[model samples]
Target: MRILITAGGTSEKIDDVRAITNHSSGKLGKAIAEAFSAEGATIDYITTKQALHPDNDEATIHLIESTADLAAKLNELMTAHRYTAVIHSMAVSDFTPESSVTIEDLQDTIAAKPDDLALALKEKVRERTEKKISSDTDHLVIVLKKNPKVIQQIKQLQPETILVGFKLLVDVPMIQLLDVAKASMEKNDADFILANDLAEISGEKHHGYLINRHHKVKEAQTKSEIAQLIKQEVLKLEEAK
Candidate 1:
């Protein structure tokens, strides 16, 4: 079976040098990839540049930096190749910078001299429309906007492909976590959803659940166990198909 797995945290650029990203080590995803590869499955592992990836000859690795990059690659790969399943374990950012203003623009707009400040501000606005803003200034403002739900597009892109998604909650009750996980599965049209809580993950024991349309099928107390369970679930999906 051919499988496409995405792991890691996607970043959103705030400026040339600054970005917003989440805390994902890509360990679980990597473990899943390795497990599948060991079973003689072809694995296409797409991950962020910051993620910790595995060194396996059986798996092909593709590195991406931002949510846009991930979306484009997924579109391209889904179109170019036919996969049996796709596991989206990446932590995609919900919001991205709507508009990024350079420090130069802010500096020109709020120049110390009052008379020149107005003229400079007007000129800066006009220049902003004409050219890319420079980032050499001291301060900048980055406006954030909601990003498209990338996972929701998976079923639309490849109707036959088995889709697995992930839901992460920080310090939430078990009931609430399961509720959100179920909602995510329904909304994304996923074959399965892995729900994890940050509070539990931070502890010595990492806990997670694998939920399907019927109910929660498996629970894992460690990262390794989560990876094994994911592999088992994928096998079950293939067998059912």
Candidate 2:
């Protein structure tokens, strides 16, 4: 069996020195990769640079930083190789900095003796051009825009691959969580969806549910247990195929 897994949180640049990202440790994805590798599957572990990964020599690792970087790597790998399954556990950023204005630009405009500082500042809000904003100012405002739904593109890229998605909620009821997970599964055409709550994850004991198309659900209490459950589901998918 061959498997591809994405783990960790994708960072979106806010400025040259700052980014917006999640707190995912990538431990679960790494564990799943190791479990599959132990079962004789070749694993391609694509992860963010900040994610925690295993030192196991059996799995090949690809490191990425930003959401664009992740998307490019995924496109390249999916086009280049065939995999039995894809586990997309990466917490992709929902919003990215649409445009960034440098403090220096506004200062320059202010120094130009414009009648209104507000109008000059508004006029200076041009499209993003530079990779890094100057750090000459003490404060800055960054405009944000919604990022593309990268997970929705997976099935389109590889119609036959088994895709697993994750839906995380914060302090929500189990029923609502399940409903959201089901919706996500349908929308992404994913074979399985892992649903979990942030409140539960913060505790010493973590809990999550694995929901499949057949309405079958498996519960796991720990990251390792969830990894095992995912591996079992992968095997089931392989057998069915």
Candidate 3:
């Protein structure tokens, strides 16, 4: 089957040299892509420059930066090709830097004790003009804005593609994590949602639950195991279609 996969984390620019990003290593995504490669499936891997990637020469690579960049790239590719499946494994940033300013620059507003700190900062923070923020200030304020849900747009753009969404929680209980995953799956129209907790993932002991459209769940421990489980499920997924 032909597939599309996204890995790593998006970096939101604070300045030309400074950014806000996550610690996603993209190891699991690489493992998943490699597993599909072993089955001789045509694949395209979209990832950040810092993330891990497949060694296969057959897989096409698309490097991306911010969440908006990722969304734009996905839109272009999905519109151009009829992919059989889409594995959205990237840890996209939820917020992006809207403005940055120093406390001294907003001294008048701060002294007024505005109740809404973010709103006050947004109204007063100067738009970034320099490549790098000035280091002269002892304190700095950065205002961030929420980003669009890129995964939610995938199935909307290509409804027939088997969409596999991933949900990562810090230390929530399995029940809560699965509940959130199920809700996201429904909202995003994803065929499968891979739910995992950070506390449960360590080295080769990564654990996840693949929750299907029918609410049926499959447990897979380790990245390789998860990839195998997804591979097995993909066959059943196509058969159902």
* C-alpha RMSD of each candidate structure in angstroms: 5.4, 4.7, 2.2
Model 2 is weakest, by summed lDDT over 10 consecutive residues, at: 121-130
What does the lDDT read for residue 59 in candidate 3? 83
Per residue, candidate 1 scores C-alpha lDDT tens digits across 1-241 of 8899999999998656678997798888888888888888888889977898878586888999888888899998889888888999999999986555666655546666657543455455555653455657677665577888989778889999989899999999999999999999999999999999998885336799999889856899988888888888889878998
Write down the TM-score of every candidate.
0.83, 0.85, 0.92
Tens-digit per-residue lDDT, 155-185, candidate 3: 8898899999999999998899999999999
1 or 3, greater by lDDT: 3
Of models 1 and 2, which has the larger lDDT?
Answer: 2
Where model 2 places Cα greater than 4 Å from the true spot, the runs are 101-123, 127-139
lDDT of 3: 0.89
Error of 1 at 83 (Å): 1.3
Better of 2 and 3 by lDDT: 3
Better of 2 and 3 by TM-score: 3
Clashes of each: 0, 0, 0
Which pairs, if any, clash in model 3?
none
Full-model lDDT, candidate 1? 0.83
